[model samples]
Target chain A: MGKWIELQAVPGARDRWVRAEPFGGTVSFRRPEMLVMVDHAFLGQRQPKSATASGRLDPAAPYEAHLTVGHRCTVGCPGCYIDAREDGPAELGFDEWQRVLDKLASLGVFHVALGAGESTPLAFLIDLAHYARGLGITPNLSTAGLHLTPRLAQKLGVFGRVHLSLDGAGRDHMRGRVGFASALMSLRILRAYHPRVGVNCVVTRASFPGLGRLFRMLKREGVVDVELLRFKPAGRGAELFAQMDLTTEQKRTVVQKVLQLARRYRMRPRLDCSFAPMVCAAGYDPTRLVRMGLAGCVGGSWLVAVDGRGCLSACSFDNTAGALSWSDLGRPGMMTPFTNWIDQAPSPCAECRWLQVCRGGCHVVARHLTGDFNAPDPGCPLVQAQA
Target chain B: MNRKAKTKGSVLSVRTGSNPNSSSLGVDVTWLLGGGVLVGLLTMVGQTLTRWALTRAKSKHGQMD
Candidate 1:
């Protein structure tokens, strides 16, 4: 067994040795003086020395935020997670969203994912992206591509990243009759100007079979980065959950296939944190899986979500977190209370083997499945097998 | 210096000798060749064992703490 040690300087000239043990490779370091240490292992497995040395984040700052700009969407897919409707909750006006952006910037959030209902005005999205850029926050836009006009695409050129949603080649059936064609046409147009366009594919049982073909199609289009969002039972998604959710066997197959395809095509595929358990189920080390950035569940900790109505959530799918308005920023703690609330692991999660990596899976998904946020994620094969 | 001179003289004598196929010298050469092969095998085995152990350790424990 290989042994390694890191000595961190603490207050009072004290040195703390963070030792990596031989048997379990467990790392232990405790020093109040250390502002941040990047040496974190996932599922009791140590990462590469470079990863451990470079992984640093300020404890007080959020790494990312998903900001919903509007509540109306045009691509009314049956499985839309937000249950976004034409007549859904009114979106925060441009001025209100600007205040939220300022608050996020003040909180030290570096990246903001701007998404809206499919029907959101393109003008609002462009203005908000520009505003976020002015605040020194790198904005990432997620869109259904229904309204991705030449003017809007040109305006969105300033975005750090743009995620165009596409499920499979069967766009008509997967995303709606018009969504697939429109998204593909927009992607073609955007590629002419934008260099960092990525595809966000929602992995569901119906879409799983066509993933390989879709990946090939994406690679042919010169797109190298694809983020696979796991299907969650939220909003309008719950209605189709029974038919769309992947079985354990299917989950294993899909994960293995995706991993193989990613390597074969030299594509960078990032799975949502909800798929961490699938990696564990595939008998792979979570640490290695995390090197692909697919293992850690950063919800409520590294990232937070704000709905169109100014409601704060641990993630876009998690709406249980209380309302966070512009007025809340005047308080001393601001969003700390909400961040802390969602960041705290439940008692049941302590016993999980993948606790360090998976962070007990998505709390919203757990609550949706078992009717308790504290319950282990029902999607996890380990949790399912236990049950 | 005397030992080296004596060994060189002995080798010259053997090369010029009538009985070139001496059993003693043949045995010594065979023993040296066999010893070399044995050492080579042992070195290979040692290297293989060390590699196996390291791989097993990594797979089981991931990394040392």
Candidate 2:
């Protein structure tokens, strides 16, 4: 709600361009070109983003908040930031979720991303999606797509979009939880729907070689967009950093290759380096992706994770404050105390080149692996564009 | 903006690539000025005529003109 506005892509335009009136401007239509270009004052929201309208939103507005439905996760992926060592139960109840939605609504938050723990409870998620949509807020969910059955996918049609994680082409890196065939089957099921199907590929030692191949397959399969996520050295991610982390040269090569692949295939791939360069506004960015023209994680500040026992944590980053209940939030009257509980990250990440893009990597991951979320990121090599 | 003339000449040129006069296409400002001015004038006239016609029809139909 700061000085920024979010624009969403509507499916019908042949060129598929979205525009927004910059705070006080009007939209202009050019008949000959059949193109609508807002005056110089407006901002362009769609990609192959216009360089003219690029500027930072007022940082004062709360950035996007990433919320965890529960600490429950079945997968024991080695690099997972949210993996609970033991099988944690789904702690969030419908009433608590409703309250959270109401709070976000009151704040005029436009985007809310629900991840962490599996989001397979269709009835609950559908209600949540409907609630967000009712408030004209966009609700995005990141799922393994392991349980995205036909019926479930149809139900999820209410949400803005779903970004399914596909770390590699085969089950080689996915361990045993997400079979490649199963993920692809789910993709095929989702492709027949209205919402976009985005594939998230985490570039790691296990999946690096297959990145190009995955892009190729997505293009071959006629998928419109994909996301290349740079792996952060945090949580279980830190343990494997020695093997999974790329050298500066290799990182450059990977970015170049991915850029080339995207240009060649005309496939829209969002480069997510939220875990790199250490400092991130992930927990601070506004969730107005649908209302404001900005992208990336939005409304991540109002987000908090409440466990089955009603214990609160910033995210999955443990050892900071094990499990404080709702009563411990703050001075009796406060709403979002999770933002205060998270420690501020240190820099060159603070003054990094990609600071504007990646506010800071995940705090939980940074804290667990390096014991300091503010320190310069070791994974920043991947965030740099290959000149 | 000299290249603007070249592009216009290329569009109007008989043999786009084969013409030896391609290098001199930039000098052909006449086409650009003439065509551009004509377009502008036509747009104004077209708008004016459309408005006039609409007004006339409205008045004839005893509606607010």
Candidate 3:
């Protein structure tokens, strides 16, 4: 019952959201939450072409899985969640790792993510990628890029997407904090293989002011896609308000700048807020890049993540967010936090103006920061202004 | 014609009413509703347990020292 929204653009830049005069709002499908609502209500509910003529998928479906090769890291960033769990064991066994992957395949998994640690062994990671490819699964790996050696990169070059952490320019800002240089070197090697390489830039107190420099460097490196991760205070990073919490107005300015930069480099920058459109939950829907997040969950069980100790979690940040644990992995029909959310997200979130669109802010983020899943979305400024 | 009639008679016998091929119709609506409530309660228990576990882990394993 909410208004339909769309993307409006400024001259020389790509279209953004602006209200259409008579319709009273924008007119683009960029807002999937709103678009999905419109398509179902106003437009007749027709089955998608991807589905069978009968309007459902066949019983036999394939799924993707996530494998956490090792849980060891060489660097300690100021706000990293992995660093908080440094006390855990080193890695998951090869066979146990395979079991996680096989489970994903059984569930129709198509995409797999590796790493929440410093280095997932070059040999084991390559083997996993090769294995995923053997099963026709796309393997995506994220790294601080600090420990990625030239030799290792050349060897494990075949991958779906290699996300390198490029926090900022110069050794001073990136060195001990987020390990950007090693990630750069790794990115260079990955480029030799010509796999799709994207940069994960964490916007924090230290790196927010360096966006201009960071994007320029990315352009020069021939990187086209960048994922901007907003800083959420979790784990050791939870004390960030004292150092780097952005005010509402500041975040708006930053979001606008990010959009401008996206146009400048002709590089697609996906915001966790924009791309995901909902709060992520751990362990409910097993068939998405994200299990429980609204839009970002790779529908069809695309993305899966496993940690070093052979623990299965929905997202890399799952441990910090506090959802289902490693212990719940093999149970037949265990009740996961995600399934409950799917069934019982509160009324305000379920029936809100943005519910169909935003998927009720990230629960993990909500729980960690505000202690409530029903709290106002941190992106309230953008969501409210649009409607 | 007699075989067709017998087949229809058997089909009609399976139905509660005399509608041949209608088959049996039963709704276990209570079980579905009951499962929903059970799931909700279990999730609350899980969250409370997880919070407690994380608090304990944070105190024990969640530090830089």
Runs in model 1 lying further than 4 Å from the true structure:
A1-58, A171-173, A286-295, A326-349, B1-65
lDDT of 2 by residue, A142-192 (tens): 666657778778777775556667777775346337678878887788777
Candidate 3 lDDT, A24-142, residue by residue in tens: 11111211211111111111123244433321111122123445566565566666655534454656667766666656544434346665555455677778778766654456676
The sequence of per-residue lDDT tens digits that candidate 1 reaches over residues A1-387 is 222322122111112121221111111111110111122322224444444232322133444578777777666788888777878887788898988888876655545788888778867877887887776656677777786777678877767677777777764237653556677898887787686787777778877888888888889999876777677888888778778888777775766687677766767576666776665665654443332223345555556778888887656776554565543532445544323332465644566655665666665677787788666677877777776
Which parts of model 2 have CA positions greater than 4 angstroms off?
A: A1-56, A172-175, A233-235, A275-370, A382-387, B1-65
Candidate 3 Cα misplacement greater than 4 A, ranges = A1-66, A84-87, A171-180, A273-304, A320-336, A339-351, A382-387, B1-65
Candidate 1 chain A, run of 10 with poorest lDDT: A26-35
The Cα RMSD across the true interface for model 2 is 21.1
**lDDT (Cα, 0-100) at A77 in candidate 3:** 69
Alpha carbon lDDT at A222, candidate 2 = 72
Question: What lDDT does model 3 reach?
Answer: 0.45
Error of 1 at A149 (Å): 2.1
lDDT of 3 at A110: 38
In terms of lDDT, the best-performing candidate is: 1
- Candidate 1: which pairs clash? A19-B65, A20-B64, A20-B65, A21-B65, A73-A117, A73-A118, A73-A119, A74-A118, A74-A119
